[model samples]
Target: MADFNYAFISLVLLLPLALLIFLYLIVRPRSVNIPLKNRHVFITGGSSGIGLALAHQAASEGARVSILARSLKKLEEAKDAVRLSTGIDVAVFAADVRDYDAISKAVDEAGPIDVLVVNQGVFVPQELAEQDMDEVKFMLDVNLLGAFHMIKAALPTMKNRVDRRPASIALMSSQAGQVGVYGYTAYSASKFGLRGLAEALQQEVIGDNIHISLIFPPDTDTPGLVEEEKRRPELTNIIAAGGGRMKAELVAKKALNGIKSGSFIIPCNFEGALLSVATAGLSPQRSFLMAFLEVVTAGIIRIVGLCFQWVWYDSIQKWHAQKKRT
Candidate 1:
């Protein structure tokens, strides 16, 4: 009986060990390190907030940085800020991401980009019933289509970059992209669209040594978030409060580190990391250890995800009940 029990315990341990070995072998694309130093890192929406912070981080890391935005004044200010902080002068381009022609022109002028950070985004928080169609379209245009415009413009040059090193395209997606949130229907849709873009684009660009990173940052303390909070629905605020928020600088640092490491899914916080694993799906994973963790934790994470949903729905129901009482 004791021998049988020992064998059972051994089998249990071996099962996971075997699974880990299997996952390590099957993980595709393999591990890679995309260095940022001496590379040209181009960022959009770099006039302020996370974009500006990314510009500063990239420049400080020894990369030649370039910032683009609609306002030349803000772009100049961002450039000066980077220079003051890092003593590295970053190129500034004035253009709107929604305008393909303008973005294409800016990309051409910026030359071959080693790292293209599609950081431009706009959000208006309102329920689908109350949201303006124009605002919905605006979010889709700037957050989703704008990414298409920037990527389409930069791909050719990025593919032909003289450096021939591993290039990166990092998309700034929100935690809302991972899961639908109340009063963020349009905004979430736009951010969700980025995941599809990143997944498919990775397949297309892998041959060119271009890696894709989808950065998922929870509510970040940025100017955009400040504005968004002012207009956020009470229910939306209540539901979103659980994810917490990170400073723009901290988020940027996390994003840049993820880009440099060629990580496919860059989660800025512990919650974001759990979301990434829960939503791993068929996304390419380079790190075998992460793959193992994803596989092992899948069931538990799903239960946790369901628990979160329960709480969110409970909050919604109570909120409505309170409204009825009032």
Candidate 2:
């Protein structure tokens, strides 16, 4: 019994070391670097907001940038904006993502895409019972199905890149995608679908050296956001209060950095970082260190996540009770 106790200490110490080595060598994520310079980067919804900002950033980084949107005028404005900001004249393509044929033709005209950013989304925040079915369909068609169209059109050439360098496909999700919120039912469903798409697509394309990045940005200050705010429910305003808004430029910068590094999950702020850890799930990791962190902290982060859920539930209950009294 004395010998066993003495040896137990050494065994415990050796176990962690052995596990770490296993994680580092056998279970570590595969490292990939998806370069942006001189490569073609196609961004949807690039005429405004996050997409436009990403276009400007990519052009500044010497990528052959292309902006796609439903509005010709907006695309032209985006082109001029990029030219003025970065001295790079980006190609402009007008196509609605809901129209797969138009997206296909646009992809053909754009030549080959080394990086594709599916950044277009629309949100009309209201409770499910009060929301129009058309609005719900619009969100799904644009936010979720649109991503499918863009990737389907771009993948063949992206997979066959002669340069043999890594390529990236990024989907612009929302923080709401990670967790359901007060008034984001339609939008959340659409964005949450992207996580599943990104995960499965990564498995499908990893052999071709194509990587996927799912970017989750909180409330971003943009023209669309102003419109959304006017229609936002009071309960939603209270529920979404603390996340704070990120400027489009900052969000774009974080997104571009994540794309370049081939990050599978790109969280855009401090709260987002916590959400990322808490909801990491089965998302692929390409960084060994991040994989280790996920493994080590999964349990604790889940507990934290549950605490957050409790707070959210409490808020919902209080809001409902207050309404009853009124």
Write model 1 residue lDDT over 79-192, tens digit each, in one string.
Answer: 888889999999999999999999999998998899999999998999899788999999999999999999999999899877788999999999999899999898899999
- Give all TM-scores, in the order shown: 0.98, 0.94
**Candidate no. 1 TM-score:** 0.98
> Alpha-carbon error at 204 in model 1, in Å?
0.9
Query: Tens digits of per-residue lDDT for model 2 on 212-247?
Result: 999999899988899999999887877676566799
Considering every candidate listed, which one attains the maximal lDDT? 1
Give the runs in model 1 whose Cα sits over 4 Å from its true position.
none
- Write down the lDDT that model 2 would get: 0.90
Best by TM-score: 1
lDDT for model 1: 0.92
